[model samples]
Target: MIHLLYLLALLLCVAPLIPGLLGVVLPAASWLPPLGLNSPSAVAWQQLLSWPGLGESIALSLFTGLGSTLLALLFTFFILRRYWDTPQWRRLENTLSPMLALPHVAFAIGFALLFAPTGWFFRLLAASGLNTDNAINVVQDPYGIGLLIVLAIKETPFLLLMSIGVLQQLQVKRLLAVSTSLGCTHHESWHKVILPLWLPKMRLPLLAVAAYGLSVVDIALFLGPQRPSTFAIQVWHWFNEPDLQLLPRAAAGALLLLAITLSVLLGLRGLEWLLVRGTRAWQLNGPTASTYCGLVSTSHAVNGRYNGAGSPQTLHPALITRLRGCATALRRRIPLFAPFVLIPLLVIPTLLVWSFAQRWRFPDLLPSRYSFRFWEQELEPLLTLTGHSMLLALGSGLIALVLTIGCLEYKQRYHRAIPYWILAIPLVTPQLSLLFGIQVATYWVPGQHFGLWVFWSHLFFVFPYLYLSLEGAWRSYDVRLDQCSRSLGKTAWQTWWQVKRPIVQPAILMGLAVGISVSLAQYLPTQMLGAGRISTITTEAVALASGQDRRVMAIYGLLQGLLPLLFFGLAVFINRRTSRYSSPYSSQGHGPSDTSSTHSGSHHANDTVRG
Candidate 1:
């Protein structure tokens, strides 16, 4: 019976890949019956090759994807290594959850506002008497530096969050004490000992970041170079073109994008095994890594030499004043992190403002006038859309939760689950690229249910995150408690329901929240699979955001993101309730100490954990 349920669940969760992949592949290969191209040929591939700057586009993809990923890793590492175990670590850990909660679109939009030529900073520069003619033009620059920075900053908090578990699991105190006794500094301990273990655990999250960077369309569309967009954006434009016949070409591009994504993921895995885990030649042969740990010498060393700064006297009044100023600077710098968090704020307003203004045109800075007419007119139709969106989010989120629990249970019994590379398939590539082929393949299936296909697509995509979210909880769970319960005569199912479930309730809630948010924000899969018949809130927001209206766009954008945020907030509330003194189990007095909401990796959490 369990096998049947697992098979059904696996098929429901993973079967959509067939349609999605085949949908993209058939068109990509120029073998489509509907378009009257009955014969299969290499024409689509040829056409993809002939596009101008294809090489540069690939280079941009690789550079942006790899660059942003490596940069995020380095920055996250520095942040944790410098702060972990220090007085500031708690505050940093606390800040990561909220920062991570902000969505990518919201972050990209805010980044453009902060750094664009006519960005808010440019306005301030104009006020400061700086030459205003050329506002630095960082936004949408060909080099994609602006885009790279946005991705790096946006993902930093996520890496930090993922690191929390790995760091706690590896036991930082033992490593720290050993390294200190051996004459290694705190940073050195992190590099030589903690890192080798930490990097492997981080491999999954890092791959996720790499894949998102590789295939992201919305971010690339807004901030990446325009003349020759990233491969993902190029595929999106192909899909959007009025010429339906160009679908094959779009599919071809998507195939290529998927290829690149997989290749990079494999390369990242190989690189990690080689450098961090492969051999300890660098660990033994090379000098201690502490000097290299504090700051990536590459970014700092060059700057130091070029700038020729002076060393100040320590413990002197001037030095104390400078230290105090540095401390103040760090406090103020927290808001600089706000572009990732606050951009959604402005984008929401922009989306709302645009949705209602009839005469508002681009570059006008404001709508001529606003009306509630769009809201009044569209609200009736949007009710159906909202219902569909909720139904889809709920359906996918629940499936993801079940699948995650199943995987966890399987690991408990069998000591293994699916590999990370397989799990990351839906996450690290362009949905449009992969989904194009998948969409084409979907049509080839004997029948059609746009809603069913889309729900499965969401499940495939949301699974990795749900699993990622729950893995921590599953690991942190006190298995001995289960053993104790079993010894006390409870059956496996009963113990799971009454004890284990209640203990991991917070994680389960958070996983569901993550799943819902992921499904809610899905724009490409929902739009592509639904084939224009099914419009969700995300699809509506993206469609209306392209127009000249502001008031309406802002209102919709806010709601678009707000819906998921509302779910996330609810999940957190539930998690706190059920997991904190929040649950009836709170009388167990597990409160803050039993569960830090930060780290739960210790098998003997009572003895090994200090936080």
Candidate 2:
């Protein structure tokens, strides 16, 4: 049974990748028989490399991708190191879900509203008597700085969220206590102790960020440079060119883009190895090596905060003084999360204003006039598209959830799982590289079921994230409960249904929400597979963004953001309710065990009634 389920998962999740990749690979090799290029050759590669400004585009991609990834990593670690156990962390943690729930394309639109040359910032400058005519344009800056900054800001929240699971597993309080007791300052301890440990565990999330930075298309299309564009955008244009002869060049470009993405991923992994393994001298040197840094006093370094036991009996003057400084620094930098957290806050209102504005020209602090005309005009089409988007998201998310639970349960039963690298192929592989082949594969079917194709494509992409989200919970689940239920004469299905599901239902809900969000955010897959016939909210929004109708774009952006926010909000509410109901004292003042036995008794009663 487990073997069949494993095979089904692989078929659902990993099989599409083969055809998707081969679709591009064959054309890149000049073997597209349909195009009459029967003989394989390197002509396509030569043409791709010879394109004007190709080198500049590749350079821009590398700089933006690598730079944004490293910067976000630094910011995430700094924030975690300073405020992991501090009071400010609670506030920071609260904002992560909403910030994450906002889809990337909507965020890009909002970012442009704030930073464009004629955007809010420039308008503020104009109102303040500052010259606005010569202001720099960051939305599509030629150097890709705008794209880099936006990617870093958008990705930091995700990295921070991933770190939550890691830190919990690491037992951070004990680790900090042990390091500080060994004569290390907070600065020294995090850099020399925690960082090395954290980096190794954070490898996959970092790789995901880097991969995204390298291959992002929707955000790049909205905000990245236009003249040469990033490599991904360039490849995108080529793939969509009217002339079929140029398909090979596009295929070659996709392959090259894939190569670049893999290289960046490998480079990040190598950097991690160098820091954690290849060069260990810096980590193992000594606590006294950098103890006297301005962050920590000598007496504090010697006496330490507490012994390895993590108690707080002794408190010295130097320790007190340095601790105050650390707290102050933490408080100071804690506001850095504001701009990231505030983007959605500010952008939503700005979008709301724009959606209603009839004439809000540049340099105007507020809209000159407002009307409901845009909303009224778009209401019907908007409803239809939103319905399609929701249907796709719901169908794909639920299917992905079921498959993920099956795979994880199989792993639990067998104590073996698919390798992370294999699972991550759908994630780390550039969509441009695979989507072309997947698109072609859709052609061989007898009929064009655009909705079905889009649904399957969404399922393919959403499965990995849903599976990854549930993996930690599934692995950490205590199988003892399963055994106990079985020993009570329950079948495997009964044990899982009555015992295991209730305990991990919160995680399952969260995974479902995440998968839905992922499906909602998809732009390339919907466009490629839907073949311009189906219009989801994302497809409609991207098309409108190209036009100058800011009001319409804002409506779409807000709506695009609204669906995921609604689902995530639902997940949070359900999770809280589950926690309350599952609490030891929440069962009409009954104990936790009594509540469980009561649930079990009810389950048995229902089974007996059915029998």
Candidate 3:
């Protein structure tokens, strides 16, 4: 039974990629049977190369993809270095669910409201009697800088979340204590010891971010360059063209996009190897050794006790001390929370205010007049779109959760697991590339199965997130508990239900929330597979983004941001309620003192499962 379920999970999640890729490859080679173009030639590639603005589009995609990944990585490291194992870290973890719940489309919309030419910042400048006409634009800037900024800001939370598991496995607190015993400061220990281990484990998440930044269509539509849009957007445009002969061009562009995404993933993996494996000497060189070498050279220079060569050994000790002091001061002064936490705080209110502003104009801090007329006007359509979105999110999320549990249980039973790369393919491959082929394959079926395909696509994407989210919980679980249950004559199913399920319940609930959010945020699958028949909140928001009615756009955007949050809130509530009665010791008939010990042990084991 476990084997059957594992096979079913693989068939649902990993098997689709084969046909999807083949679908694109055939069309890209100009083998469309329906269009009667059976010849396999390089014409599609030639046309793709000859297209106008192709160079600029590719450059923009690369710049945004690589640049955003770099910034997000740096920001994540900084946050972890500053807050991990501290009281402040708990507060920061509390904020991640909401930030992650905010869909990228909604975030992009809120981002525009705060940073556009006529947005709040410029209005404040104008209100202060400063000229705002000459202010540099960020939203939809031609250089793709705005897109890069948004992607970096949005992706930081995910990388930080991934880091929690890695840090737990690395035993960061113990490692820090060990390093401190060797006279290493916290900052030095993080760089020399923790970072090397963290980077290799974090490679998969980093690739996922890089791939999303490169292939993201919804956010790009709102904030990406317009003149020669990102390559992904360009391919989307080609696919939507009315001319059927241009199908090959679109397919070729997708093929090219896939090539680019694979190349970037490979490059990032190599860079991780170079830093962690190839540069072992730097990491292995103890901080004490480096500090002693520097201090000795400084003392030699200060005392004018250089060797016969008579070259100054290093800067004076006093200068080195001053530099170190300055660096510490600068680090302390940086506002670590502003980018990751503060911006989302501001975005929610900005979107809310915009949705109800009846007569708001530039230079007004608050709306001059407010009313609910916009909300009233959008009430029906908003409800309809939200209903569709919720149905998809709930259906797909629950299925993915079940499948994830089966896969994890299968791994535990057989001591075998699916490869990480197979699971990550759905995440690290360009969505546009996969969806285009999948859409074609769906056409091969007899009738209209749009809803089925959309739901399946959501499941395909949501499963990976659910799997990764719950993996830490399963890995950190005490299998000895299962052994103990079996020794007590409990069947395998009964042990899992009565012993294991209650312990990992919180993780399971949170994973469901994450899966729902992922399904809610899906735009391409819903758009392409639904063939414009299915109008979810995300698709509606993206459609409204190109219009002039900020009021209507705000209504959709606000709802888009709120729906996932509601599910997350429900998960947190249920977890808290159920946790009070579901103690592991409750079933063991243990005394109060034994129960206390069990509680502490469970708490320690599940610390990494919280977020």
TM-score for each candidate, following the candidate numbering: 0.81, 0.88, 0.89
lDDT of 3 at 32: 86
Compared with the true structure, the alpha-carbon lDDT of candidate 2 equals 0.79
What TM-score would candidate 1 get against the native?
Answer: 0.81
Cα error, residue 422 of model 1, in Å, equals 2.9
Off by over 4 Å in 3: 180-185, 288-334, 486-492, 585-611
Better of 1 and 2 by TM-score: 2
Point out the worst 10-residue segment of candidate 1 by lDDT. Answer: 600-609
Instruction: Give a tens-digit lDDT track for model 1, residues 92-177.
Output: 54555545555666555545544556555565676677786854576788988887888888777777766665676688888789
Which lDDT values do the candidates have, in the order given?
Answer: 0.69, 0.79, 0.83
- Ranking under lDDT, best-scoring first? 3, 2, 1
Candidate 3 local lDDT, residue 395: 96
TM-score of 2: 0.88
Model 2 clash pairs? none
Model 2 misplaced stretches (Cα beyond 4 Å): 1-4, 288-290, 293-334, 583-611
Give one clash count per candidate, in the order shown: 31, 0, 0
